[model samples]
Target: MAARRRRDNVLVAVLAVLAVLGGGRTILGWFSTPPPGPSDDTTTKIVGRSQLAESFARDFVVTYLSASANQQDKIAEYVSSGQQVTLPSTGRQVSDPAVVFAEREVSNPQLEVWSVTISAKVGKGAGTAVGTSSSAAASTASSSGTTTSASNASATAGPGRQYYRVAVSVAAGRVRALSLPAAVDAPGRGSDLALANQNSCSPDTPFGQVVSGFLTAYLTGSGDLSRYTVPNSGMVAPAPAPFVSVETATVSTDTTGCGTGGGTARVLATVNPKATDGASPTLAYPLTMIFSAGQWQVQRIDPLPPLRNPLTVVVGDATQGPQVQSTPSSVATTSPSSAVQVPPAKQN
Candidate 1:
């Protein structure tokens, strides 16, 4: 028994020593550990959006896509010498050219890449098109064992949005293309999906009235959200609200949040918010509500919408992309285009 007690004492003493060391390191910063979270740039020590890389990448894509054979000289301003970007023979015009994704190279911090998507309204231009080389995506086989290539299939199919990815080197504060831009596919779209909120709620009902009234107060600050929500939620309306008016376009409830929801329910609503500049943008909200004091009361807005998929981690994020999640404890986010595809340089 005495031998066992000695062993136990030794083990406890070792653990106590470790605990003290750990506490000192955490409280006094003794071991010089790195920060618990990301740096001020919200990323790593080597990679960052430091050089206005997004702007340069966006401009490079726009100039490359506007490939008029006669105006190939315009590309020289973006792409480095000795490198050539394939120009579409039929001219392409791009508009609303926005950067959808930006990426940084950890191995090479001086290099940044971005993917810019242009829902360009392509129009036919009579000018000649220039391409360094030609390759066919779709080929036809003739009866004589001969093959033919149709490189202009996409060009003839019609006009629509196109996506491009380009990498830029922000070396010594000079932003230039790291390589030729390559055609990238648009984000994957989901089809035939059902959601809990179908905008079917009538504003005349008590549920609808409460949801409509709460949103109006939240956006316009004309009323108080505390009046519509359960007490102690501390939901505050924005001071000097951004919208002039809020209209409930559609609303619905999930199975648990549907019906009279005498005790508790969830309400999903779509609102048309008119900004001060007369710009009306549609917004969606996923919220929870409670029934108390013989009346319906608003609850905290859920951080995420309810998903109805069989094998899903975040179906709503994939489908109801633009929906906003608001709360003191939660934040809203959207999908980012942060990938790039760098094709090989042409031989000719």
Candidate 2:
């Protein structure tokens, strides 16, 4: 009887230990957190799509506007079958078709579309019709008299500024469709004044003196500009003139659009260039002045009514290949005698 009771007690103790372990596991399972599942970030995906769209739009515009027969052939590769490529028959030449902005109009896993708007200078020139300019005689002989007159009319049309819109579509990492280019209105000019920041400089201080001195040097192309401009300022000295005449000089404490101040000021100066032959046209200078090395210096000279898009590509006739022209830093106004204040330099 004693041996049997000891065996029973050992069995009961083993059962209790197993029950305790099982219960502990069950409790832990109820409170423990599961590992996180995979997540997809949509922001990164959207940004990537935008970049792709912009690149496609830029390339399409450049290629479509190309006068080269080789470039025209490349356009078909970017679009699907049966898509119409309606190019100007008169061979409209465009310069500086820069994309000011672009955005995605439609997005999907299988297909994406983008709308790109650009600013360009559009012009028409002689001998831009299909085929070589030397073929003018051949065209005249093959076509009717009216056709020749039409060609002449096209040749006489001058160039004008215009904005354009292009639509691009992508699928499976390839351009699948493209829309015909269309003309659109340009965006309105934005405010020229920059927001007030720590870099602001007063117009009457050394900054002003620096601006005046720099303008004097710039107009006459002869002055001690070292005391008034930073080294490597890229300020081009005007060619020597018989005399420099300043009709107006307006100084502003507002750096608004010029740039961040190390020491900078904006000066709107109306200058009259008097040459030995006669009185030259009056020009305006929207000057940005910077202070450096214990003196205020000229930093940058902005074109009046700043260019909307600086990266403009000039497309020449068939004989001439496409050429890229940098936006002019200084612009001459059409009005010879206008008291227009220089707009402030914008923040980059």
Query: Considering every candidate listed, which one attains the maximal lDDT?
Result: 1
Q: What's model 1's TM-score?
A: 0.51
Model 1 stretches with alpha carbons more than 4 Å out: 1-37, 42-51, 67-73, 85-92, 109-119, 124-159, 191-206, 215-226, 230-251, 254-264, 270-283, 291-294, 300-303, 308-348
What value of lDDT does candidate 1 attain over all alpha carbons? 0.60
| Stretches > 4 Å off in candidate 2 | 1-75, 84-100, 104-113, 118-162, 169-178, 189-210, 218-221, 229-348
Q: Compared with the true structure, what per-residue lDDT tens digits does model 1 show for residues 1-348?
A: 999999999999999999999888788775577677756654642344443676777777777777677776888888765785566675566554555556565335554444333222333421222111111111111112222233443444433445577776676456777677877765464443444443345566666777888899899877556767777997777777989999998767654323344777667888999988996758888888777766777789888765444322234444333443321232222222221111222243
Worst 10 residues of 1 by lDDT: 131-140
| Cα lDDT listed for each candidate | 0.60, 0.53
lDDT of model number 2: 0.53
Q: How far is candidate 2 from the true structure (C-alpha RMSD, Å)?
A: 17.2
Candidate 2 weakest lDDT stretch, 10 residues: 332-341
lDDT of 2 by residue, 145-228 (tens): 322333553454444335568887867666644766677765554333221121223334444445555666666655555545
Clash total of candidate 1: 4
